[model samples]
Target: MPDVQIRPVTADDRSAWLPLWKAYLTFYKTELPDAVTDSTWKRFLDSNEPTNAALAWQNGKAVGLVHFIYHRSNWSINVSCYLQDLLVTPEQRGTGMGRKLIEHVYATAKKAGADKVHWLTHETNTTAIQLYERIAERPGFIQFRKPL
Candidate 1:
């Protein structure tokens, strides 16, 4: 484990958060327009939004990021937390940074009165699956999507 501090992102964190955000998208082989990125940043800073983000800092540098959203669930009365995005710098992977970021989300979600925290990752993300298995259960759900 590294001496890292994790906290909610603020208005001042855009510069530090953008690179990590881009790296995450690249890891997933996806890209979004600048407008979407700008809107996401704004959501993180907005108190009224259910979407939130955090950054992990070590030695005065941001090393990881996590984004989560709280939404109503049909099966539960309490909000369900979706751990949407999690990423650590390539050099920081396997140093417990990923787990720490997730644990941070777990704590945050729990504090926010969420019933459970869940997320999805590509089937080919074997490295992340290893870590995820250690921390969460696989519920045997397959996702299907259709573009409108």
Candidate 2:
């Protein structure tokens, strides 16, 4: 793994993050319209917005992105961080960049005084789930979704 430098999202990263974000959605077979992408960039880049954060950088021009948020949980006494998405260009996958991205999420959660950090994956996503098992225990919870 090359020395991957992780940093917070910046206003200038919008250009770099878009294609990577689209690729991430594609990787999961999720479709995100262009307008939603524009809104997302605006929200995260807005200094006053509290709902989003991201880590961005490149491995020799390949982008890596991790988007996360903190939320209140009724069962948890303290706030929790939810890792909404994590992506590394396929070229960066085996280079330990994914783990590093996850670790950055954990560290950010800790620094923010969150009691826990969690995320869900498709049951068939064994590769990511396997990596997750090492850094955090899997909490058995089946996710359900309905379009509004």
Query: How many backbone clashes are present in model 2?
Result: 0
Write model 1 residue lDDT over 8-53, tens digit each, in one string: 9989999999999999999989999999999999999989999999
What lDDT does model 2 reach?
0.80
> What local lDDT does model 2 show for residue 66?
86
Tens digits of lDDT, candidate 2, 36-85: 88888888877676556565465546458888878888988888998988
After superposing candidate 2 on the true structure, give the runs of residues whose Cα lies further than 4 Å from its correct spot. 56-62
TM-score of each: 0.98, 0.90
Which has the greatest TM-score?
1
Q: Candidates' lDDT values, in order?
A: 0.96, 0.80
